[model samples]
Target: MSYQENYIKQLHTLLRLVTDSVEGYKSAAEHVDSTEYKDLFNNISRQRESIAAEFRERISGYGGNAEVESPDLMASLHRSWMGIKTAMTKKDDQAVMESCRNGDQALLDAFDDILQGDLLNNADLKTFIMDQRLKVNEVFLDLDDRYFKLFKKDPSI
Candidate 1:
């Protein structure tokens, strides 16, 4: 593929992942019973919405069409699985938090892949991805710490 096409493809992939995150967090908010967790999930969903918007803008700037429709099927299935897991675990908050943590890790992994790949050689795009990745990593760390504390497990383990 040409350079432009390759970059556009990368942007689309990031866009899809961010969109999936938004939906995933929204689903988490619905599955959890705690008001605090619900609010947290909703807030994160909003943050991801903003990030997805930036991605859309960037894709459009490159003359590529952004997929503004529903997130992909995998994300849908994962969200459904989360709901089922929550039900099976009797609405356990820890289970929901763990799923959220996993989703966040997946997003971070996508960022790492793009950053380490040759297709993202543009300095401006690189900076944008790095900044976004840092924000996502911070969220992941917070969720992970909370998970360990809630389960009374040492993080070092």
Candidate 2:
């Protein structure tokens, strides 16, 4: 596969994870304790869904399968971890803090891979990837700040 082809496959995997993460977050919002956390999860879930739509379209435009070719291993694992943490917290904030850290790490890993890879020759995809990286970084940073404020120890973020 061309680098672009690999990227397309990777992106489809991302979309699949995003879809599952969105669903998980939505469930968290409805079943979680705090209204603030609920709202945050809901908003983030919607944002992820929107990103997934864009990814699907971009993949299809490239003559690739847009319907999520593979599972997002990291995100799926993160979701499971988050659920366990949610159950363990019992209204404490540590679990959510752990979740934030894991999410930050996942986003960072994803964007770092995209950033280090050579995609500049593909103008359209390169631009899109750059934009997504910036967006993902922004979200990660914001979540890190929130987690720091809530947890106040910087566990691993």
Candidate 3:
């Protein structure tokens, strides 16, 4: 495809991921019993929405149509799996954190691919993508620490 088409395609993919992240965070907030986790999820959800809005605006500036698509099948299945796992194990916090880590990893991978691609010669898009990549990497680091702290040692052992 043409360069512009490739750029629009990548932006749409990121937009979809951001939109799905908002929903995922909301779901996690609803399922987690901890008020701290709930509030954090909600705030992250809002921030994701703002990020998606920025993406939409950027897409429009390129004279491309900004379409809001449903989250991909894999993401939908991941959410369902998380819901079932949390319900069965009653490990809401762990399950939600696991899901968050997975989601963050997906986003980080996407950002990495976009940054590495030749499609990002556009300065504005490259800058935005890099900024997002940094933020996502920070989140992944925090989640990694949180996960290790929570489940590193088995209480039964």
Q: For this target, which candidate reaches the highest lDDT against the unseen true structure?
A: 1
- What's the lDDT of the predicted structure labeled candidate 2? 0.70
The residue pairs found clashing in candidate 2 are none
The lDDT values for all models are 0.85, 0.70, 0.80
Model 1 spans with C-alpha error above 4 angstroms: 153-157
Across residues 25-53, which tens digit of lDDT does each residue of candidate 2 receive?
67567556778877887887878788788
Return the number of clashes found in candidate 3.
0
**What shift in Å separates residue 24 of candidate 1 from its native position after superposition?**
0.8
The lowest-lDDT stretch of 10 consecutive residues in candidate 1 is 148-157
Ranked candidates (lDDT, high to low): 1, 3, 2
Off by over 4 Å in 3: 152-157
Q: State candidate 3's TM-score.
A: 0.88
For all candidates, the clash counts are: 0, 0, 0
Clashing residue pairs in candidate 3 are: none
Residue 101 local lDDT, model 1? 94
The RMSD (Cα, Å) of candidate 3 is 2.0
lDDT of 3 by residue, 1-157 (tens): 7777888888888888778888888988888888988887788888888888888988887778887866766667767877887788685687788888898888888878887886557887899878766876876797788777677654541
TM-scores vs. true structure, each candidate: 0.90, 0.82, 0.88
Candidate with maximal TM-score: 1
